[model samples]
Target: MAGTGKAHLRSSDNAVLRVEDLVIEYPGRDGSAVQAVSGISIDIVEGETLAVVGESGCGKSTLAKGIMRLINTSSGSVNLLGTNIAALKGEALRTVRPKMQMIFQDSISSLDPHLKVNALVEQPLKVWNRGNEEERKAKVRDLLTSVGLDPEVVGDRKPTEFSGGQCQRISIARALTLEPKLLICDEPVSSLDVSIQAQILNILQDMKERYGLSLMFISHDLSVVRAISNRVVVMYLGKICEVSPANELSERPLHHYTHALVSAVPIPDPTKVSGRAVLEGEPPSPTNPPSGCRFRTRCPAATDKCAAEEPQLTYAGNGHYVACHHPRA
Candidate 1:
């Protein structure tokens, strides 16, 4: 059984991106197939920030690449801005790419070290023929300024000459140059300092409002995800276990896995002592996942039924959904 269900997926016309029963696989050892992402479905409405939080190797980045069509999926459909991304090929795929953009985890590696900051940001516009040379340059300056960088000071410098945070800002400017309707950020702030992370997150929120865009933010940091996302999806192994409002997930998690994840987030209370481990054990290999519930192996409440039957997402209350034999809610 995979993580969160279609129970919460809305049919509203405002949805910018939708993934239905998406399954992504890779060739494992001995030519066997490894399911990285398994039968997951999610939707993002216009102007909404959907945060995906999970442990490392939980298919967060893989899901992002799948939606971006950077990697081919074994089966499923990715509908973006009224177009079926999974069905696109060559020119058709290139034509719809401008409407969606991705900001990777590695800022320095993502940018071209040889290209100047101005040229890096303006390249997309020039390739798309967005406007004349003067117009493109003006837009680049505006984007840089909006991200709190000066065009005159940093425009001519290459990415190798700048700091990680600076390069990330440049990446953001470059991503925004196309004015994409949807942006998928894969751990965008995880590599920076705490203060810098705050700054970058603030910039993303500002850009979201200014550009009228929707976002799919993937991070392992629950606190960061809760602080910025409208809704949160919790994944374990290759499946999603819970989907809930950010605030509600923090306060009252439905699934046991969700509760364990919430409990793992550090609480900055000086007077309080260390907390007990609600969750135990590592995840199973994706190449050979456990039968029935993927999380039952680690769940304290696991039962014979949990071992025999895979649970589907059942609706709770207040827009929360969980796939667990024994949900906390």
Candidate 2:
């Protein structure tokens, strides 16, 4: 039902989600505003996983929330399936909310601790009046089994009874109840153990294929992003610094910020010696971010121009884009 109208500017026919110049801010204690997400644009084509990576407070999660319309936005538009969801209100917003779903990082906290797993997953179907009681139960059972959980055994258990990994699987099952076209995963595997992380990731991949879904995966872990994402968007202080294919970004980063991030990824080969780019100090406060380039303060290659003139995201060959005045060769 999405993408019903004519394509707007910068909206791709193939994209399931298109965000343009999106800005989100909060009222600071003082009179000023705290800009959590600066003007940014991105497109996620159908069936592609677009990974958003950055350090803490870099606004990755805020971007995800903005896209989902969980919070109010100051300006810009979020076009989902050709509908500008940012402008939708009340029933209109509720109508489109079912098309996109979000999975949070704290799986246990995200679930309703008092409700049984079957009820939790079936609630969406009930709200939408999708099926009869027996049909809803059958769908819930299929969803639980698809997520690697045995519905017959775990269906009646409350969320508190499950481990973190199992809770996440339940969360995924709940999100898929409506068969959403888009799944926004905000650090969905960060809290689980390494072994458990792989299991959840595998399930997500399986679900994506089974449901024909597009994913917006947000995380701080580069290795995990590399493993699951097709394209990667690197953010710094609420602004995107680079966008590139996942493999290309890992192997050859163009933006200095991206270069530093890639360098921090641990290499598996003991014999391969590589120099790590250690950034100095912490990210500047978003309320009073630095002029020009947001990342210039910690970038080793920062020059006077970087402090005076803002650099826009420009192509750096082979579909890679970087927002840097002096991009690395």
Candidate 3:
């Protein structure tokens, strides 16, 4: 089904990245394939953050991997700076990869625990063969300072010696080594404490502004997505349920699945208790997704048509798009 979401935020004159009907699948038994991301598409404008939010196992990370060409897609296309990434091979892919970097969820996992911070940060430069030893060292110092870390002390330490937040900073530095135009961050802050999350997010915001970078930020947390995103895409079972401006989606979610997600965001005010649409049971397996609407099983407002005919994502209003037979709007 064609998703009918239009760009709410003014799209840039030139789209930095475009993903069209991208489908990713893993090999299954008997030559079948388990679909991970199914017919997903989005655009990343320069200097803007596009957040992809969903429940665990909704293919958020898989989508990120597909965009970066880490996982092969069954069909569809991903274009970065006018190049079809799916069609790229060998030297072409190698040439393009440095321009699109990913920051992993686990800082410790992304970093080489044995390597000192300087070595880790300089690793990208070394791989790209950017310069000699002295130039690489100077670049590492600049990267550390840019991410609000001390070049002298922390640069000499190992991943094991730093805090969770600091390690993430190092990971960010590694990502910045090539001065990439696009960054795909897969829940980069989910592993950190609340205070640390704020700091890291702020750093990202500053860097994004400074560099005019386009970001594809994937996370399960709605509040975090709302904070940093200009636009948000809500995913359910390997499909996009809704796409809208961040504030618009947060304030008025059109799809039942999206409403459930936004309502579940924690509200700190005790007196202003939220009346969230509590979903029942766990998300169904993607191995054999439910017929029609994937979320119908958990949706309280599900109807007969919801089980018989899947809905296409259509515009509700103001460019807000939702895919539901009976949208909340």
Candidate 4:
């Protein structure tokens, strides 16, 4: 039930990353073009973290990839720092590469095992010729230390030798080497232990404050998102179902799909039981998604109108927006 609308987004002047009507499609099963992301418009203000959460096949990762231009998009504009990077190409695109960086879900796999940790962190600066040899090394040490890694101890080691948490720390240091304005993290702490997850998250928050970074964080961990993000964007089958402030979403979700996701997040206390919104069956195919409301296949409040016409994202008051035929109010 997602349609084109910009009501959910803030002023472009206040946003560091603004995506308008973004679409990303590619070949799927039987050669059908799978619309991975369909007409998504979202923005992240400077020094804010916008978290995108949904079920596995909801295209959360694809949306991040599309904005980063790690994969080519079919059509749309990705405006970063007042410039539409989606339309830029060749030398121009390469020139702006340092302004943005992405951290993958797999920490170890994302880093280079062949290179030492110090070299790994310094690589980005070297590529862009940001500083002289000594200056780069000094900057790398400062960043590694900022991430809670001792440069003296772990600097000469490769990524494989370190634990999952340490590898993620090294990745973060590398990402910050160029002082990127925007960082896209694809479940950066999902693979680590719970304690490790907290450590990494703290590191991220510290880095964000230190560098004035705007973040687009994609994760299935709603708890983490609510704790760290300024705002949350609930996605469903390549479309955004809701956009609300993080605490506001946790307390009062509107969209049926968003409600389901919020309900599924386990409550911290065991003495009190929370109501569950159990979704039946699996998600429909994205190659040929259900007409009208894509979440209708699994939504309980779906009706003939939901099947006939798509819902546009409309303001639901108090800085909340939802796209649904029957919002939870």
Listing every candidate in turn, what is its Cα RMSD in Å to the true structure after a full C-alpha superposition? 1.3, 4.1, 2.0, 1.1
Candidate 2, 1-329: lDDT as tens digits: 00011122234988899998888998998888998888878889999999999999998899999999999989999999999999999999999999999999999999999999999999999999998999999999999999999999999999999999999999999999999999999999999999999999999999999999999999998899999999998888888888888999988898888888888878889998879887668898888888888888888888888888888777777778878889899
- What digit string (tens of lDDT, one per residue) describes model 1 on residues 177-231? 9999999999999999988999899999999999998999999888999879999
Runs of candidate 4 with Cα error greater than 4 angstroms are none
lDDT of each: 0.89, 0.89, 0.85, 0.90
Considering TM-score, where higher is better, how would the candidates rank from best to worst? 4, 1, 2, 3
Q: Mind sharing the TM-score for model 3?
A: 0.95
lDDT of 3 by residue, 1-329 (tens): 22323333235357888888888999888788898888888888888799999989988899999889897888888888889998888998989999899998898878878898999999889888999999999989998998999998897788998888998898988998989999999999999999999999998998898767888899998899988999898888888888888999988888888788888888989998789788778998889987888888988778888788877877778668888888885
**What's each prediction's TM-score?**
0.97, 0.96, 0.95, 0.97
| Residue 219 miss distance in model 3 (angstroms) | 0.7
lDDT, residue 33, model 2: 90
* Model 2: per-residue Cα lDDT at residue 218: 96
lDDT of 1: 0.89
CA displacement after TM-score superposition, residue 106 of candidate 1 (Å)? 1.2
Q: List the residue pairs that clash in candidate 2.
A: 3-81
How many clashing residue pairs, candidate 1?
3
